[model samples]
Target: MFGLFKRRPKTPGVARLEPLGVDVTVPVNQSVLQAALEAGVDFPHSCKVGTCMACRSRLVEGKVKAIRDFSYVLSAEELKAGYILACQAKLAPGDRIVLEVDIDSQRPHFPQLTCDGRITAQTALTHDIVELRVAVDQPLQYAAGQYATLRPAHIERAREYSFAAAPTPGGDNELRFFIRKTPGGQFTGWLFEQSRVGETLELTGPGGDFWLRAAEAPLVFVAGGSGLAPVLSVLEDAARAGVARDAVFLFGARTQQDLYQVDAIEAIAGRWAAQFRFVPVLSHEPADSDWTGARGLVTDYLAAPHVPDLAASHAYLCGPPPMIDAALAVLAAAGVADGHVHYDKFLDASNLAG
Candidate 1:
């Protein structure tokens, strides 16, 4: 009776976000990122799984209980500077937390909304990729290059997919995505197993910071597999805005059969305000085949003389971890500054299986 009557420990606290001058309540058992999101705060984030480091914030003042070791993703200097992954840090019970987070002014800030959507169509894009068109219950507003989390009616965990096209000025109730079936991906496996048209899904998003920045630097875009989704969105948006900047798109595929949307890209190039080059690099194309384009890994072309000044370009990359890693190495070797490089790594079930 005494134990039951005793005062319970207070776990809920307030987190003060600097630069933004906002305070959000960190609920008991919720991480700082979770709290911020619940409060409708557009704190930067991607792969809320302690990866990506997009939600990295400096602990200005407070005690935090880390759910996992931050040393794996955060550098020693960053750790020394009190930097922490907000998704992995929970406010200590009854402690006031003060955090410093850099908010980009150019990044679009839209209220994240949740809505139900029905799969209206699914078209095969390649042997392992499909294009899904969903009609959401309410208009979903998102910027080009942003991704959304989707969960089917019965799926336990949601998967992230980038918007395959640019958004309309008002909003678009119809959303599109290009999904590549990962060998053991839960959502993807279920999606490709059968015709899922008319099936309902819950979506939460407009997440990630992969959108195009306002810059005059020449553009270098790299994509592979379904990673082409965001790249296409960004390009479409740029074309619509009449952005007059030289750009080159490097798309990687295993063979001719893997290529899709070549015609659409050509159409975009026609509308582009400046010179635009689309290079599709085939890695496993047959030697005897009629394919005459570049051969070998896509990164090989990063050094080709035909490529523009990579050292003075803004490079946007989206793809599997290996491809992004390879592209990063190539760009670094070509003298592309780290700040000029933007990327979004597509992670599948195998990546988080550990």
Candidate 2:
């Protein structure tokens, strides 16, 4: 009878973050990143999935059970150095853990804000892409290229989308996003199938570390599908700041119809103090179409006789995992340093499941 009353083994259920000196509870089945966000740790992260390595941190002390394989995104050196993605880490039968995080000090940390937002407008940009403009009840402040997590009342899980433009100074009450509809996506399916313009949404955010860095080097922007959101935001912020660095934007799409925001991009280029070029590469455009622009994959045009020298440029890339991988290979071969390349990989439920 006493055996039935024996106590269960205890887990520390605690994660001690270094540098910031914050301690947060890690509940069973909850990731370390989620716990930190709940405790207001201001951890840098995007795409809560394991794809974007933004939530990576050093596991200084303690073992963690990873939900996914880290070999895909993290390098062998990083793995050897004990770096782990907080979004995929869970307490693994251990005591308290000590983690070293690199929180960006360049910009002031904006506390995670939660507010009710109403969909003010919905404009279809492509066959599967939609631009959603939301007006929130309170002011929200965030750096350009950051993303927000939005959930409609009917959806069980919220999805993250990058801000499609720079925010108004002194915190703006309106937010905008470009969302691509995933065929089986719960949120995107609902958004595309119904008129959600007047519907209220639960919004939380201003998350992510995919912002523009201060540099004098020329900029190389590569984007695919709806991944152009943050790229556009960064360029807008640069234009507003009067930073006249030469830039070349290589945008990729399947067909001519997949291209969007052309006039808007041209407007940005119009005010560019230095040289600016926008190249749209269509991978599968019809052979009979009068498309005189660049054809084939965007990676094919990265070499000379195609685009200018990229050896001294800073590159920003965003897209599906495959596209990002291909672009990274091309960029590396073109002499672009590893540190100069920043990227965000968009992942859906299928990726999370994997």
Candidate 3:
């Protein structure tokens, strides 16, 4: 080996900050938030997982790289305006930036920790859908419409499920999840066949930034399969808060048997019938059955005459990517503002592997 000069720590990745006029340097490989924290600057962060855009800031001078995986939610114009998520961005040397501290301070914090929980109850909502109730060792506070990662002990695999249960009054320790069996999914197979009451499992909490925000706009919920989880959570949370805004939930399935939680939706509608409506859409039901509700694709229902004023309503969608794509187009065509349409696409890696 040839003798060579050693590399210096100040070579490149170090961030040279010019915060509010004061200049300083930070190490490379650290996110903007981490750099701020190390520099004694307070920055707001939640889910530190790059999913929440709460830590967004402006990249005034140098380039920054995103640290975590994320799907872009901001438009091209926003990026052109220098807005970038600090949690996902790594600053390079010579980067001069001004932090939007007010926006960052509003993000809610979620602790990252693994805990053990026991399966208290499990039930089949439909032929292939299962509802699980677990009691964790400690209380976990999470916003409705978020999700958790479930990993069985000694198992190398994990699954993500949305929270369907409403947050207990004053918050509680029990966690609820709604899971649908994907044809041959590894975790789903194990869950369907071997998961039983009293079985212990490991889970990571309160993931996802898809929770509801405070707004007076009317809301529409569209979902299919277990995508109904987060949608149901939003609706229940809204009803619990006594929100009087008009809301409609359009749940779709292949046939009558594929539908789950109809009664649950009906119950919520009955309680908030004055401002809420539940419509079940069947895509491939038998003609013999006397179905009086909406029929055909869920997108069709959204295009119907009874749809609320799109300009003042917010739309929430959760389902397969194809359905979400179509729903977005339909909503846009119906005059819904692009910024008001929020969605979470359920893409299973196992499905891709097959």
Predicted model with the maximum lDDT: 1
Task: Give the lDDT of residue 40 in candidate 2.
Answer: 85
Task: Enumerate clash totals for all models, in the order shown.
Answer: 0, 0, 0
| True lDDT of residue 107, candidate 1 | 80
> What TM-score would each prediction reach against the true structure?
0.92, 0.92, 0.78
What tens digits encode model 1's per-residue C-alpha lDDT throughout 1-354?
A: 455577876768889999899999897699999999989999998768786677899999987889888998788999999999999999766779899997778989987998998999999999999999999988888999999989987888878899999899888999999998888777888988998999999998889889899999999999998999999999999999999999999999999999999998999999999999999999999999999999999888885564778888899999888898899889989899876888898886448420
TM-score of 1: 0.92
- Reference-based lDDT, each prediction: 0.89, 0.86, 0.72
Residue pairs clashing in model 3 are none
Per-residue CA lDDT of model 3 for 1-354, tens digit only, reads 998998766533444433444343446767776666556543544435454354556666667776754337555886778777777877665555544343422234555446888989899988878899988887777777877778777667666778887776544577888888776676677788865789888987665656776777888889998899998887788777887778878898989888888888877887773578778899998888987777899878885455666556789888877788789888878788765777777765434210
By TM-score, how accurate is candidate 3? 0.78
- Candidate 2 stretches greater than 4 Å from native: 1-12, 349-354
Model 2, C-alpha of 260: deviation from truth (Å): 1.2
